[model samples]
Target: MSVLVVGASAAGLTTAEALRRKGFRGALTVLGAEYHPPYDRPPLSKQFLSGDWDEARTRLRPDNLLAALDAEFVLGDPAVSLSDHTVHTAAGRSLTADHVVIATGLQPRRLPGPPLEGVHVLRTLDDAAALRNALAADKRGGVVVVGDGVLGAEIAATVRKLGIAVTLAGPQAALMEAQLGAVVGGLLGELHAAEGVELRLGAAVEQLEGVDGWVSGVRLVGGEVLPADVVVVALGAVPATGWLEGSGLTLENGVVCDEYCRAADGVYAAGDVARWRHEDRLVRLENRTNATEQALCVAANIMGEHQPYRPVPYFWTDQFGTKLQVHGRPSADLTIAEGTIGERFVAHYRDAGRIVGVLGWNAPKQTRTHRMHLISGEGHR
Candidate 1:
């Protein structure tokens, strides 16, 4: 049997490696859009952007491990389309496989305008390298970030750490409002303020003003403009599902799959590109942990094991001297058990006398224990 894995990130690499480890001696192939080998992306915003870690240090799998697997790698050639059993790449290669795993992840969303110099979105390795170069070459002006999500906040924090003036503006009432909620969000606001980065909460970007053909500032909705030499639009991302269009697979927000990550007969999907069925709803997640977990599950299922891919979403963010880790989905109505704010703490989210979610701000050990509770389907003690 042959398996073709597309998108060569953590998800694709994990799926292929798990298949090999699980004793599948089939012909394996990996197709990646990026020319580089599989690498960890989370660091692209932190260590890579900050110049603490070089490109080689960010690789997810070492050359020794990847060489042992003996899987054929087709880098810099993105899969353009797919059919019943064949994946067509832009490099004019048609790969016929018994099973196809779509793990193409996502691409960063950009602002509505022609590509301007100094405008960046931190998603790919090239993006991080480019932005880093731009920041180094021109260190005279401030940066205006136009998103309040985790990516935006991280970028704001990273630039500020470089002694660069930064202004974080977003449409949310508070920073990271969608993930951390208002209370924690407010705490993060305080953290960034303490770091000397300006915050423009509850605002939207109207236009990106350019001077001399380069991005110079961001104009807000209420007629306020924040001057900037660099503009990083950290607006989330969309799944790279355009290649699957008209491929006869159910494509909603992502490639819709069964509980076992199966899209069709002999075809499976995992990672950000696969939105599996979940209790009368399609649960599509963009978390890095979810990608690896789902890909491993998909590999097992492909090898004749029947298991559902239900994941307790896990995500973390490091910004402004605080590392926040969250496990499971925390509902706004869940009873909160607060330990401490802006310091070592654990905030437990409970429902009906049972812990549903766990949030840790610097309390890694305790929060991990609580995280295991969600994984084992047990309530908080």
Candidate 2:
């Protein structure tokens, strides 16, 4: 029962580890596009981007731990296509196995503009290093971040800490409104503003302005130009499924899979790339926690445990020295479960009178305790 994982990142690596932990002694191979060993991405926007941590510190696991798994890691060669249980890499390597897992993750969306020098997107380790160098090189220049979601807000916060003037422009009314809701998102907006990040909310970016092939500023739809030396586009990302095109696998927003995380007879998917049926709907989660959790479920099912992949969604973000943790889906209907918005607090999100989400604002201990509310069904209605 040989297994082939087509990504060496968190999801792919976790799947291989879980397989070994579950006593599966089959051939295991982990492939990656990046030459660097599997590294954590969440830090790319904060610690890695700000140079607080070096590249080695961002690695998910040390060399000794990875060696214990005893899996063949094919790095720097990306999977270009998949035919049945065999995957063809760009390096002209054909790898076949009894089971193939797709955990290719996502590719960041870029803005439609000139290929300017200072325009950037944060996705991989290389992208982070490039952006970090650009930010550090420009001592007197400001940055214009063109997204209001979690990634954009985090980048702006991280860049501002470097003493670089940051202008956060986005179509959303508040920062992370789509994920954290308007009220809490607005509170986050205030936090950014208080920390000297200029907010340009409710504005559409028309295009990028450049001089001599270098980004000079960002032009909004209404002809307002936000001057900047560097522009970071954090619009969002789509699943990396271009390689799976015509692979006979259903690809919508991601690799479509069943409740068992199986896309076909011998093919499975996990992490950001796998959009599987959850209850009545198909859902794809893009967080690190979901990546590991879904991979474990996939590995167990492959080992014949046959368990369904059902998990309470969880994600956390740290910005400006404040840590925000969210459990379940955040919504517009929120109640102050503990403390006040000005200080540490936990908020419950309700939908149709049922508590559907929990959010902790700098209150990790209380947040963990309140998370049981969702698990124990104590706040269902």
Candidate 3:
């Protein structure tokens, strides 16, 4: 059997490796639009932007490791179409396969503003490299980040480390509302303030003003103008599934898949590009843990072994020298409370007297223990 994996991101690469580990001796081909190999993205906004790591150093696997898997690597070519059992590439190439995996991941969401020359989004390696170069040259200017999401907060912290002023503006009341609760958000607000970073929550940007085709400042919706020499738009990302339009697969926000990551017969989807059923709801996760687990599920199912993708989704972010790790999904009605254990802590999120999720800050051991309980269905409340 032949397997065609579209995308060379974490999910795609992990799926290919998992398939080989499962003894799939068939023809395996990995197609990637990026000229470079798959690399870790979590560090791009942190160490990479701070000049602490290079592209080659952040790679998920060395070149020889991929070659040892005996998988055909198609770099710099994007899969433009998937019809029947054939995958069509943008470079006018076609590959027929028995099973196809779509792991295209996501693309940064762009804002409608003036042609600001110094504005960028942190998603790809190119984005990180550009911002790193710009910040290294001008370490005394103000950087206005337009989103308070995980990426936005990380970038703000990174810029502040370079002795640059950063103004973080977002529509939400706090950073990562989807992951961190309001109380934690308040704590983070205080944390940023103490770090000499400016926070403008519940603020909307009207437009980006440029001087000589370069960004100068941002005009707020309330008519307040903030001067900024550099602007980074960290307004999250959308699934990169435009190529699968009209492919007869359910596409609601992302490629819809079953519990096994199967979108259709002989076709599977994973990573940020996939939305599957979990806890009686359709969820799409954009995290490393989900990507790796879902890829493994797809790999197992493709190898004639069925494995359900029931993951207690976990993710982490390092910012301002604090490591925030989260496990499981917290409901809006969940009872949330914070507890500290001498610099190591846990935020318990309970739903109807059961612990549904746990957020750990510098508490890896407790996080792992709680994660096991969550997975075993014994930690609710």
Candidate 4:
């Protein structure tokens, strides 16, 4: 049996490796749109953008590992279509496979503004490199970030580290409303303010103004202008499923899949590109842990073994020298237990006397123990 995996990001690579590890000797091909090798993306905004790490250090699989798997890699080629067990690339090439996995992650959403110079988005290596070059050239410029999500906050933090003045403007009332709750969001605002970054919450940007083909500032919806020398739009990502429009596969916000990551008979979807049913809920997760777990489940199910993908949805972010680790989904009716112990602390979320989520800050061991209890179906003690 031959397998073809599309989009060589975290999901694609993980599925390929899992299939090989599961003793599948069939021909395996990985198609990636990016010219560079598959690299870790979480650090792209932190270490790589800050010039603390090189591209080689951020790579997920080394060159030797690719060779060891003996997998064929078609870098810089994007799968434009999948029909009748054949994958069509934009380069007018077609690869046939018995089973196909769509792992085409997502692309960074762009703001509706003039294509001015110095406007950046952090998603791929090229984006990070370009932003890094711009920052290294003039670290004293006024930087404006147009999103208040985790990526935007991290980018703002990194820009502040380079001795640059940063102003973060977003439509959300606080930072990371989707991840951190209202209280934590306010806390993040305080943290950024303490770090000398300006916060412009509840502000809507109408347009990006530029002078002599360079970004000068951003015009807000209320006719206010915030001056900026470098504009970074850290808006979130949209799934890269545009090519699968007429592919007869179920595509909502992402590719709809079953518990086994199977979309159809011989096709599967994983990672950010997949939205699957988990217990009583349908979720689309964009975390590394979800990608890895879904890939393993998809590989096993493809090899005629049934394995359901039940992930707790883990994600972490490093900012202001603090590590924020989250496990599982925090319930809306959760009771909060927050305390500080020395330099380590935790904020536990409990729903109906059962711990559903835990957010750890500077508490690695405690987070691990919480993760263990949550995974083991244990309630808060």
Best prediction by lDDT: 2
- Enumerate residue pairs that collide in model 3: 353-381, 354-380, 354-381, 355-380, 355-381
Which tens-of-lDDT digit does each residue in 1-381 have in candidate 2?
Answer: 999999989999999999999999989999999999999999999999999999999999999999999999999999999999999999999999999999999999999855998999999999999999999885456899999998999999999999999999999998899999998999999999999999999998999999999889999999999998899999999999999998999999999999999999989999999999998999999999999999999999999999999899999999999999999988889999999995899999998888889999999999999999888875542
RMSD values, in order shown: 1.7, 1.1, 1.9, 2.1
Tell me model 3's lDDT, rounded to 2 decimals.
0.85
Ranking by TM-score: 2, 1, 3, 4
TM-score of 4: 0.95
Candidate 1 segments whose C-alpha is farther than 4 A from its true place: 334-338, 351-354, 376-381
Name the candidate, 2 or 4, with the larger TM-score value.
2
Judge candidate 2 at residue 64 and give its lDDT.
98
TM-score per model over all chains:
0.96, 0.98, 0.95, 0.95
lDDT of 1 by residue, 180-291 (tens): 7888888899999999989999999999989778988899999999998889998899989999898999988888999999999988989988989976778898888988
Return the TM-score for candidate 2, rounded to 2 decimals: 0.98
Q: What C-alpha lDDT values do all the predictions have?
A: 0.89, 0.94, 0.85, 0.85
Candidate 1 residue pairs in backbone clash? none
Model 3 TM-score? Answer: 0.95
Worst 10 residues of 2 by lDDT: 372-381
Q: What tens digits encode model 4's per-residue C-alpha lDDT throughout 283-324?
A: 799878788888888989989998888877788888888788
Model 3 spans > 4 angstroms off: 139-141, 332-342, 379-381
Q: How many backbone clashes does candidate 3 have?
A: 5
Worst 10-residue lDDT window for candidate 1 reads 331-340
For model 3, how big is the CA root-mean-square deviation?
1.9
